[model samples]
Target: MTNPTALELISRSNRLGADPKNTNYAGGNTSATGTETDPVTGEEIQLLWVKGSGGDLGTLTEPGLAVLRLDRMRALTNVYPGVDREDEMVAALDYTLHGKGGAAPSIDTPMHGLVDAAHVDHLHPDAGIAIATAADGEALTGTIFGDRVVWVPWRRPGFQLGLDIAAIKDANPQATGCILGGHGITAWGDTSAACEANSLWIIDTATAYIAEHSSPEPFGAELTGFGALAEADRRAKAAALAPTLRGLVSTDSAKVGHFTDVPEVLDFLSRSEHPRLAALGTSCPDHFLRTKVKPMLLDLPADASVEDSLARLQELHEAYRADYQAYYDRNAVDGSPAIRGADPLIVLIPGVGMFSYGANKQTARVAGEFYLNAINVMRGAEGLSSYAPIDEAEKFKIEYWALEEAKLQRMPKPKPLATRVALVTGAASGIGKAIATRLAAEGACVVIADLDLAKAQAAAAEIGSADVAIGVQANVTDEAAVQASVDAALLAFGGLDLVVNNAGLSLSKSLLETTVADWDLQHNVMAKGSFLVSRAAAKVLIDQKLGGDIIYISSKNSVFAGPNNIAYSATKADQAHQVRLLAAELGEYGVKVNGINPDGVVRGSGIFAGGWGAKRAAVYGVAEDDLGKYYAQRTLLKREVLPENVANAVFVLCTSDLSHTTGLHIPVDAGVAAAFLR
Candidate 1:
């Protein structure tokens, strides 16, 4: 860690005596001031402060502290066959404090030099260390504090551990502190008091849980496996078993521990079935991030060959990998990113328990935590059941969502169009009704334009007052009627910012059997009606100079080419093209034009009547009962294209987020386009 400033030093010293975790420990240290000069950046650094040797923090003074220049100490760690002799290490520390002829610095100076945080506190709190070294410490910690604490798998302290902490801090920028698995707890904060408080809180929580869960004697019968092996042989077997166990579980096993000594460990390994032993962990989720879901359970055979054991482990790994992949594949959506390069599995050396691995410390911690929680849950559930988390497809959607990805892109602060007014045509029911509802919800005063006078008034009443909503009857195809609708909107709301061209008719008929009148009626409502409404709205929008939103409700058949629906399809296609040209012409005024093409909008009025539904279904060679299912299955998301979904698309385009977007046609078809391509 870097050295603290005068203010930081005072703050740390004050907290040192107050923090119970630091009792009897050497006085705390600080990092150097000024910028650190490194090979990467080569900048000047102040100094590094470390706890002085052989002094208790509970009663310490400034003389008990060791201050060393950060740059010189950092240079030492980079050297190969780094100085190992105690005298040499002390000499290096002295040079850091007073040049080549300076006083001696703390022995922990090298470790402090490696930390990234401005402040780092290392304590060997008795309670923390005692609990940490216990077999089921991680699980116990989780049952105590839940999401508030982070756990690091056991690693030898010094440069490597400091580097690991730096990585963990980077990944979890919000963590209050960290616990070293099989070691002790470390807390960090912007201020010394905050850090000290966090440390106390963690210890207290862990202590409470331990007091409640710990037993005078073993709570469950122990299981036996590897107690017979010699110490040297046990260590070698455990080291070799790490990879094999990891392979069996499809997780990283480098972090797993294989202890050859200790009564609890030995006794647990002696039993044929390890009961309470199943619940052990280094820490909670934070630790699991490094370790993975579960450790390898190793049960050594008295006469079994090491090769056979390794092979069995390999088979287990294969089985786990296959199952994990299957789970991921089952829940994943089309075009989603793969969940993991390899399965996040772990092996438990029966007596040794779990371990984890990652490309970095954070990854290992995350893997370890996940494995730990899963094991606790599994053990609690007993062998009759196990946790089957979300499948890969669902996970992929959440992990690789376009919306989530968009959040990564730079964006300006959002501004609300609070004073904007909107007019939605054919607002009495169906897609138009949905559009009207949505616009109102977005704080826009809306005029529900419909040809049905009574239904229009009723819809307006349902949506509330004229300030936020008004019902007006106007035949969308009639030029005068369209003008009246626009005049009403302007009169009531002052000016217009949006116009939803949702009034359209759907008629199903083969070209030969279709009457000219039927064709004209369809075109009049779907195409000509759109022109009248748009032409009327564009005048007010252009004059206001405030820009605006124009949304056209087109059908998927416009692109898919449905049979026996020639007139409706052609008119929809024309409506879409109209949007493109409108967008081009309106760009100068900052007005946006877009369209939503929906496939199956169930529960709409008139559109599904007149045998049109049956006729359309017949064209597709399926009964009406299966239409929704067919459409859903064909879609990549397997979701119905509801009117509400189309409305959502219209609402998005109408908002300021798309202020720069224009002349676009977004299909709210739930991956229909991709389905067609497939």
Candidate 2:
């Protein structure tokens, strides 16, 4: 068996784009320009050629190849929006190559250019697509190549994609090829034959797996106990789920269009078991961010009442919101605000498929995609044999993760809170500063309200050059000032989606030394101040019917009352309880209330600085630094807690990811208190 030559490998690569069984006219091309060394120095150099956009790789000839200088391609990364415009990319390619007549370069030219290898081949193989879209794609890849493969999540192909590959190359420095999720694969090597062989190997692996386990049995046979519903009954069920969904979704594009042509839609919707439909996802994870974890499961009874259906939907939505809030609060750092919202959950009418209500198209799309993919994976896994998705704790970690949250913060498309207003109290430092910074970064017009107006302004200015942060002077405990501040935030940001109640003081006075006046002061700042802010935020969160987060920064002292701090400890305890009561009462109106109880946060602001740290240190007969060391050593993880650690927890609780959590107190104490309690 003779090995294929470089020209033969290029021919095979070009032919892959034309295979209908693989990519169906999604535009693919391949190219090969022979090596070119300096004429004077005789140094080894490579001249690359890529297939033009409209030219089919299968039929591509030398004329279809666009020759270019690899050095010039590498330099384009410095240009503004270099990867954004296709024309600019092509124009840049023209500057380096000398060719009489060759096809345009492949859109993936920059990616291939980054590879140090002599030969590169790019293809969107059908088998690769199947594996990439599978439920355990990442896990599957790991099993296939232990450490040889690198996976890149889906991103629009071109300059940006090239830059991403370049970074990966720099990191790994020895990677063979890269797999782009939901897109395709690229293989490169010292020679064209090696690159082609690698590409063929990946496709062969995926193909073999698909052939062995492509089809799995369904979840279950038709419900034997419950009789199948008639066509009219199915339509009634669909109607019942639709109106509630109307309230939850912003657009009716996916809803208005009926699945008259798709038999799967009709068959699924007609089934009495509505939960089964949630198993199908659109295609990928990016889609899930727009949709949700899951869609509504509407089981329409033959004689079901509209009110009953609506009530059920409302009940589930509330439950989900509560769960989301609780997750956020638990994982949030000390001094962060709580998660709040109404209708973050969406409904998928049995017949309607999926519908979501977000502030805009991108939000709706994100929810739709997430819900779709999750459902598909869940259902597909069920077919394979009763597979359960990751647990709530794990899901919460991903959904409320700092890195994931940062991604959203970085390239915010359109969000519900993009144009919305927000007010953050205690914004001068600690958790309050974090919340203010996050909200501003996410495109919200924010008002930083604090007792120390100058400190608030300084904090705001430090975040960014933009005037997204407005510092206002207002004692959160003062009713008049609270009202005026809320008014100011609303007037400044246009509307509100969040209010962080994070102002308070703590005093470590033993019961004997704790005066009535001292207790009142602690209660006024922590408890009373929270109420004033909530009452003020309610006007906007409720009146707008837009729903919002009301986050209270309580203390871990609330959960584990330390010795000689009766006033501060009691106030924090009350704040946690208050959140539960508020969640129950305000849940009906779409307002979410939650709290964070962080332990062992270093003294920077609030009660920790106002003699409380010294007093608590005195109880242990240690200096303040020693107290930190004591707490750090006592924890299971043996890590000192930082304000940012607490800030991370607060950020998650307040974000939309934990849309279902509310009415809970999360301990952000690095497991110290939990160890003690246990």
Candidate 3:
């Protein structure tokens, strides 16, 4: 086959990266060297296209690639200021741009460019790392591939490591790849297919060899009394402890969380070797950067009761923080990024599972995933021989490396609601849907709770993936359902920070026309529902010790004294007061309660669509289509209040702009005179 183009290089990367066994998220790089017509010179020029810094290969596009002149990149070898000043090489790479540089070049660029091959792949496959981290890794590499694949000793990733690998290939002309000691593996070939095949061969051979030489109990046999809890009990215990864990972790910065109870994790946790191996921490730089230098394991056994675990968690968390701080102090030199918080990103509960935290749901989930990769590496290494990860000092150097710090600094500033999770009731449509969408856009993971399960799920999909929004079936009036919804928020995104009590209906009935059932239904859906949702949410908010928001979506009819709105008006009034009561009660816990009063949201309103719009239109002696216009004309602003307008109010009240304001009702009714707060 002809030498692969940049697109084929991306295709190969996507295939290799799609599997967790091959590489963890954003953990590897792939490149192809090809001649392209120079945009200015109209002459063929050799360019290297590789996966960009901080981008996942599976989702990589042309724009996500860094294209650099291969000649300029190779020329970096001469000017390299040795390993002591290796970091300067990263900045020096910027000068090698082929054109208007695409994505920023990753440090791994040299690994791809310096190799004398048309195609190259650098991956952190668990199997390869398992071989790499084994105490006899160099000998094992020779035995596994019989000189077909070489072994390169541990070296920090930079220009030097790249040159070292290139030298290894030069010495062993028959080698297709090399196992990176205490790291991962790299492969190269004349074509993309050949390169990919070589990578898979290394990974697959390492895996089979380990299995062939594996011990029966790699983690030193599962402890007799240490096993996972029953499924229901496990979930309950996880939910109960999540809020406190979230609170402790978020002390420095707010974090969304992800929980996993996969069998592999449970099995590893149940083993006697878990504590020792976990303490040694993960081996790969890709793994530890996300999982942290090491995981914090609950000292208690798997069989410990939830209450006991909860009581012990605080003490353990404090100890972990102290230990982490010491680690930082021991390794941090002057100008090192001031200890990026002392909290553990991965929290291990033997019987329960793992809880990982990050700035958002996807990040939190990926952290957990990286930990799982670490687990597989441990399994393979211990099964083959003693697991020998790089020393902590080396790990610390990589963790606090200036290049890593620069990468962190380059991340965009987070949105106001980043790391926050909101549950908006009645979010399947209309006002509730609008609020959910807006909050997600502002960086909050939203839970779309509605009576209609399908619609709620559909709305959530429309907003984003499971990380951004989730759908939960809830009839807000039901206490059990309400609690379940709150618990869903906790499990889905760690804990809840915002609640919009928007699940409501309108009953346009006069005092004489309204039946007792009508009053009960309206009050049950709005007033009682808001109370139920708030009560459930407050428990989490208080437990988290993270300030929260509970906004009631009341109506203008609550105080405007509109005709034919007795039941709905009374319910709205009750909802409005509940906000004040909650604000007063939850203030000590830093929970803010507020309300939004929107008047006659006719366009795209479930309440209005459910016959209320026609009833109000008939009452006002206007066509149904003209109802919004009629309502708008009456307001001082003479503008119809859209569902988006109410959503905007919720966003404002939840942001720092109103951090000191509570028990307040913002009118989203286009300047309604009668609905004005007194």
Candidate 4:
């Protein structure tokens, strides 16, 4: 069990970090000085546990906290009159670790040590940074919090900064907190609860201060004339254009993903002054590490094809990368470690949305979350007057700092499907969700396409890291929406490798009871949806001259006759035959086309979510509860056809060495001979 005080400190840290407005992804740290038994001496010694470097304080655990000897850290807190002792202080922090733990303490460990209090909390809260970055930050801090807060001017976080903090705290013995200009805020007290209270008080009071004192938005009126994509067209265009933008930023082929529609993010980007503000720079030094000192604003041509956009994006990327290196060379101090590459983490693409880049989906998500907060702070500071943070020279030291770079340099190598991209339709539930999840697990970036945008997003969130699964709203029958879905796959991941056509519906009715509407619903969704998605996917596949896979989810009724299932049977048969022809046309381009015929899959699937299972069971003269077992008993193998069973078959078709096998149907009905092909 964690010590009660330590637990409170961690609890406070996590709660603060959980909100991006407070601490954007791994941006803040916390520490608590407590007594612990020495490993060799077996005597109680004061130990300081600051948040470990590079880990998100929001999700931090016991081991994630770095334990340091408090006395040793305090010894290094004072900068000897004025020599360059930053390097020596960093080494001292390393030497002070009390035991076997190798996790490095946060860069601000020494400052936390000199707090002379039981708890110390440092956070880059949005409101705090907004106030800190403003031209009149010092004046505002005094006006907002009065005598309780000490204002520390802009300084590199090192021994000097620690000395300054210690000196200020000594001078103002009654102050409860200190605001680090162009950086963040620190609050300390005798107890964890007291320090946390002070932190909240500071944030709340400053937020209120800004709300009342800040000037009116400068560009609010100019937004009326901004050239932008229509809301109806943004999703499709964003999807289509994603690949080109991704290709521009990709160093190798790890698929780049775009995250859009976060309410706050959208609200910020919609501001007409965003381009100008973003170009100014990040509000905090840590954000400079997440995004960059210079923001890359990508222009989307009004009417450009995927090919044309890719060409244009390539040119932009080259210029952006070169400019980044020049900025780095200009500001990099001697002994600062070289960054891996000059790729921008968050790139602004007005009229569509800003995109966050990283090696994997999670890192990209961090970039997006962090940038959203940074933008809010930027807009807030600008409203207060003009946005200005630590300039490029100050930001350079933080971005390329040896300690910060070590965190990102720790990720392992990518897996097999790291470069591949896939689109799964009807992915909100059941079979489609299973297939999409499997694809993500195998390292393929997946686009979750469904009729309901919310459900699609929820399904994607459930599958894996938010970046790997993108939700796209597409009604397959609509040619435009289908084209958009295809574009979404290419645009988001830079290329396409697999297309899973699983969006479908069925109507239960007798020959006389079957209305034309019922027939159209089934036919349009099954036959036409597959046709549209396949047609769209095939064009992209053929254009690249790269092999791909198109897997269609058909029904067992295609080959096996069922009572009161005419519409489903006929349209499914249409799909089965269409797959054969698609194989013939697409096979020349090495794009394999195959079909899976699955039996009843009722558990937690959308097919049953709307009472379709109960209605279908009634038609079959079986109780709703017995529907799955009743269907299983009729099959020779007497096994229920789970959604995962169908997913496994689809995976085999897409990934198996049966490269020459196409235009064939794989049955997922537990040995139902009637559905078997001759």
Candidate 5:
């Protein structure tokens, strides 16, 4: 059970973290001092509950709080290491734990415990940062809040910075908060509610000041040809450029992508000062950790052709990599961790939009959001005075800090298909849905492409959240819709890596009973549809230069010569050959094409439920309910094959064991002696 004060602290932290105006995601810390009975001593003791390292305040829980004894923590001042040896203090914090520490203490822990207050909040709100980053920030602080909010000089967050803030608070008895130069803000109160109000007051006041003083064009006048294009044009251009950009940024490793052209981003990109400000990089330590030192600007006009932009993008990417390498070499010390990577996490195009990449989708999205925070800070700072961020050397110290490296190393090993993206057609129900669900479970971002948009979206939601999967409308028979589905995969998850051409229907009609329409309908949806989807997805896979997978849900009828199934069998055969042909061609580019033959996936199968089951049961002279058992009896193994069985086969083909296996068909038919491949 949580104490009343701790509960108030949680509530206050959530309210502050929930609003972007208050703080960026995971960019702040909060704490409360309270009394709790010691489990061993059974005596009331003072404790400090502060937001821990690597935890987001918005979603923080009990486990995310670091528990320390106030007496032990405060005693650190006696043996306090100076700024030069502050890194050691972080390790020493573990010794101050009151019990099983809830979480590892963050570097900002001292600021909360040492300050003379019962409640403390450390936040990187854009409004406060704007004043903090201004060239004349100290002067601006005095002007804005007088003695109420004091100003602290720029110091990398450590034991010493906490000491500085604690000393400042002690001297200024009337102060509610202090603005850390070129960093952020810290507010305190004797009570949790008072602390929250004081924090909000500081942000709201700073915001109002910036609004009153800001120039009409904080980012400078709009660049003529670089302003945002029409909505349609911007999207089309973004789609065309996404794959190429994804490939470039993925050189170090594959990354999931997020694209946004929100007014704030477009407004900044369109301005003349964007290039200069972007070069200066983000000020807050939290911002740069995810976004890298700086972003890669496209350096092209909004109206430029995609081909022209793509050509220049390659050139710019090379330069960006070289610059990043140099930045790493310039500041690396004897004990600095090895260079993580030379890839740009965030890419900015003048007209189209911004593309941010990460090992996964949510991270990419959050990185972009953080950059937006930096833009807001830049805007406010320029309005007050020249924007001056922390020095580059300081950024290097934080970025390559051993503590930061340890955090990265602590991340769990990625799943087999962790960074891969897959698109499954006809995924609204049955086998297709099963395949999409299984792929998502294995960590592949999935696209549920189906004719029914609503059902597709519902399936996507059931399978996972937006980052794990998305649903898009696609009619395989229509060439445009097929292409759109492939494009949707790229837009949603960066680029397509696996495509399952599973959109199909069955017409269990004899040769004599089949009409031309039946033949064309089956052929168009299964045969031509596979070809169309394959071609569209292949373009992206090839451009990504990251070997991918394309699997066809072919049938045993393709080889077994099943009776009363001319249209269905012939279409399945067409799909089977397409897999072979594509594998031979796409193999040079590392895209593997394979096929899975599942015999009579009747139970839970959409096709079997949609009229085909009745027709097939009639031909087999069995009741519809008994058809599955009858089919299993005829197989060599006599085992019933379910939708998940087929889904499992698809998963295996995409795994590393089959990396070199392609143009081959694996039967998920529970064994069929007659349908053996010749």
Candidate 6:
């Protein structure tokens, strides 16, 4: 086979990456050596095939492997002299980019060449990293694996570092594996399968040994402050804090994904020395490349009000950026890569779970997974005594390394609505959930703004994987809450493109029997709530100078009132007119405000909750059981007008497919003749 070693390396890496306990998507790398016949020369030439950078080993294939001429690659060893081998390495990776490929091989390629074995596998197994980053790692490594493994002190991985590894292995011929202090472990053998076996053996044995020796704690036992609070208080605090946090980190250009803190994370951060421990840096360089040198640790008083927390969060944003600048200034020299913005990749909030930020959901998720893994490793290392990691100087080497940053630049372009932010009122369930789900499905980062923060969170979770949604509590009728919801959308996704007013209610009451409270309730949510949300969203859209959408969920009752539905009919009529007026005003600013009027939405709606089903059945003179079927059969197409159906109409208006069409209504009631526009 032309590159069997490449295939074998891909296979072995995938095997190691099958479980998170072994290795993460972008951590570690593997390689194998063999010879490939030169196409033109017709002579055999040595080749080294290594896993390409930023590829997940779990699903890796031969196409993802990088092949290099062994003799050419080997000749570069010890050639770069004192410090900063990045230039030489980048050039080498470029020279070795195989098969008209776009990606460079893993930066650890040169190190793999030093193994002096046919196969080499480098992995950041949970147990391996935990042990490797532990205090006095060398002695501990000696005790655990004896002479079979060699320990190399913390050294930034590059061409020179590769030479050092080879030198150490050359001297200690019997050591079949090596642990790079505060990093990860490596194993090698005569064959790919043998190397795989050695890697598993080292990781499994270390894990077992650590478990037996250390007093095991919960996964996040180290985190504390947030976990100590009452459950209800914690939920409220997290909701209050998330939006402000999202806003601070978001710039006009980029909005990072916000990860809600979990109970485990709260317990872990509750640890007394968490601030210092957090700054100790990542267990592996790969993680630092994603989460940065360390997380931005936010320590807030547990009893602080939302106003105080908001002010504090803003201040923290400024301070974090300044600190990041200082760090970059200290480490960045003449030949170093340009520095990135000061926005943090991860934020540690006391009494709340951690907030991680990334430009996109995938980037955010990768960073998050690494932090969780690091926590586990750090916890184990601390139990053994102290946790140690590479210094900031070494960390800079990995962070701005052209190879490391290039992996991101080389990523595929984002989806069209990938950068847009959206807010869906009443998103905890029903029509609101359907709209939120559709927006998220189409790649818009969404905020599930509802009265029930917990339920909003659940709805966001149910929208599916990828950190595309975050829940924010907002009573739509409350002006301040509506503003907060709008702010959350702006902050979480950078800018707002869509604001959906889907929160509504209905009650069956005759004109004479309609109570003042009933009229107030209908008008407050449908009219006042829409105005609050639209005004807030419009200011943002105008300020951003980007066209956006303000969509309202109107009702057929606006034109064709149902008997004994006086309060519902009046509000629906008022709301429909409000949408038209707003559309006319916003059209001048490129913002499209429209409405979807559906007649019979008995299913997939919160309005039908309680006795509405019974009330609706009574109005139509049908049994409660026949309500859905009756509505469906009466519709023009004999179909149920669903929440999803309403959501689809909203999607069209927001996408601007009907860019020029606004100041209108889209009927989703399956052809109600009386409700149709003149």
On lDDT, the stronger of 1 and 5 is: 5
- State the TM-score for model 4: 0.75
Q: Please give the ranking of all candidate structures by TM-score, highest first, separated by commas.
A: 5, 3, 4, 6, 2, 1
RMSD of 1: 27.0
Candidate 4, residue 3: how far the Cα is off, in Å: 0.9
lDDT of each: 0.59, 0.60, 0.91, 0.78, 0.92, 0.77
How do the residues 470-558 of candidate 2 rate in per-residue lDDT, one tens digit apiece?
A: 78888977998987787655433334567777887777778999899998998998889888888877765664555667877787777
TM-score of each: 0.39, 0.42, 0.98, 0.75, 0.98, 0.72
* Total backbone clashes of candidate 5, pairs 3 or more residues apart or in separate chains: 0
Model 5: lDDT to the true structure: 0.92
lDDT string, candidate 1, 487-549, tens digits? 666544445678999988777888898888888998899899998888878876665556678
Deviation of model 4 at 274, angstroms = 4.6
Q: Candidate 6: which stretches are off by over 4 Å? A: 1-7, 35-46, 78-85, 215-227, 251-253, 260-264, 301-307, 419-442, 446-464, 468-498, 502-550, 553-572, 577-678
- The best candidate by TM-score is 5
At residue 130, what lDDT does model 2 achieve?
48
lDDT digits (tens) for residues 388-481 of candidate 5: 9999999999899988998899999999899899999999998999999999999899999999999999999999899999999999989889
Lowest lDDT 10-mer window, candidate 5?
486-495
Best by lDDT: 5
- Model 5: residues with Cα > 4 Å off, grouped in runs: none
Give the per-residue lDDT of model 4 (tens digit) for 167-234.
89889998999889988898888888888888888888878877887767643533543345676565
Question: In model 1, which regions exceed 4 Å deviation?
Answer: 1-417, 674-678
- lDDT-wise, the better of 2 and 3 is 3
Residue 129's lDDT within candidate 1 is 52
RMSD of each: 27.0, 20.8, 1.7, 5.8, 1.2, 7.1
